[model samples]
Target chain A: MKIAMPDGSRKEMTVSVARIDEILKELNINPVEVVVAKNGKIVPEEETASCADELKIVRIVHGG
Target chain B: MLNDLEKKRYSRQIRLFGEDGQAKLKKAGAFIAGAGGLGSVISIYMAAAGFGKIRIVDCDSVELSNLNRQVLHWSDDVGRSKARSAKDTLEGINPEIEVEALEETISKENIDQLLSGCSLIMDAMDNFSTRYILNKAALQKKIPLFHGAICGYQGQATTVIPGKTACLRCTFPRAPPVTTFPALGSTCGVIGSIQVTEAVKYVLGFGGLLENRLMLWDGLSCSMDEVACMRNPGCQDCSALIGDANYKQEMSK
Candidate 1:
């Protein structure tokens, strides 16, 4: 899977989890701070993410 | 009917939307939930655009540090309640419209009374808990919610039309972690303007609203992106409105 950060950095990772939330948990990613898009589609956290999925992590910067 | 002065006052925008559209704007009201960075900008534009009524609430007092982004307050207003300061500025911008400022924190207890008779809710708060409150209130009342948030050079906005689009809770089932967020006034400007644009289009009954999509602005890259969103079938806040006929009925009011 490909990890794309909001800052334009990209990295490759082999998925080790079935669900997006699990992958997020494995990466210690806070679900509230970032949105995970799998293969260019924004899926809900509970949706499945396979080893072949390309995950893009977009950070959500919430303030006023 | 537009009086000669109102016709003259909004002549520029009238050209864009015509007398009926201008009249739609003039007959609508909005409840803005904060007086900080996003609230200040949203109220200013909504008032200047001739929104019939603007009710802005905030419990905090202006601080010297707030002048950078909370443009409604200045050095002279450092110690004044943000709501009052916002009212003064918004009224000065367009006295023809009603500007009601409340020096109260928005909560579940007071949200109903605070938004009564308003046609729309604007989420300009600094926190998500309050944004969620605003979201539920909008849903229950069948009013639209124009959402916007910012930190540092990045900001995001989305519109929630009860029963028609994704509610805030559906988009983020959990609240974002609270942090000492850095905010630039320009980021607020970008997001706030998008909110007002969606709101105006909503009231005017034309153009494409920012429904079911979160618009993201990244100043560092000078680029914008949108993430698609959909309503959660089991959304705790707004599922009741999904199939309610009253939701559609109230929207036409």
Candidate 2:
């Protein structure tokens, strides 16, 4: 599966899990702290993502 | 009816939206939640563009370090309250508009009172704790919230239309860990300008609203990208009001 990180890097990984949160965990990302989008649509933490899906992650902490 | 001075002041923009659109801008009231980096840009542009009334609140006093991005506060005004400094600067920019500055911390108890009479809210806050408070108030009041935040050379902005669009909580369910993040003044200008533009579009009833779209800007790369957003049915802040008819009616007000 391929995961697109927020820093604009794409990582190709082989994982056994189908859920988005599991995949994020495999990428060493904290699923609870970032928003995940699959194929341009935001998905819930429980939604499943496949290897063919395009993913985007956004972190919301910033000092205004 | 616009007076002679009002007509002349807004002539340039009147060409784009016409007199009625200009009137809408003149009749709107906006509440800004901060007077720091983003707040400085948002409020200044709103005032210069002839927003009829502006209410800005901030409890912090200006310091020497804030001068970089906080354009509204000057060196001589370092010891003054940011709210007072922002008000003075905005009034000097456009005396025709009304500027009300309050030096108070925004909490759940006083959010409603601070936002009273304001048609929309501007999220210029540096921290997420207060941003969440403003989001809850916006949901309850059914007022639109213009959200903007910045860190270093990266920034993001989104427009929240109560009951119609995904809210701040829906997008960011958990706040990122608090820390002292580096910020650049130009990044604030970029995000804050987009926010003010969204507010103007909302008030004038023209152009496409951000809705469920989040705009992310990377200054280092000079690129702007968007991520699609959707309302979370299980979101704690907005879930209860999702299907309620009373909430819909409140939104229309």
Q: Which numbered prediction scores highest in DockQ against the true structure?
A: 2
- Model 1: residues >4 Å from true position, as ranges? A39-41, B242-253
Instruction: Compose the digit string of candidate 2's lDDT tens values, residues A1-64.
Output: 6677878787876654488887777778887657888888778878988767777887664688
Q: Interface RMSD of the predictions, in order shown?
A: 1.3, 1.4
Q: In the order shown, what is each candidate's alpha-carbon RMSD?
A: 2.6, 2.0
Which pairs of residues collide in candidate 2? Answer: none
Question: In each prediction, how many residue pairs overlap at the backbone (N, C-alpha, C within less than 3 A)?
Answer: 1, 0
Off by over 4 Å in 2: B246-253
User: What local lDDT does model 1 show for residue B93?
Assistant: 88
Model 2, B1-253: lDDT tens digits are 6789989999999899989998999899999999999999999999999999999999999999999999999999999999999999999999999999999999999998999999999999988889999998998888999999998998989999888888899988778878888989999999999999999999998899889998989898899988888988788899889578976675565
Candidate 1's DockQ is 0.70
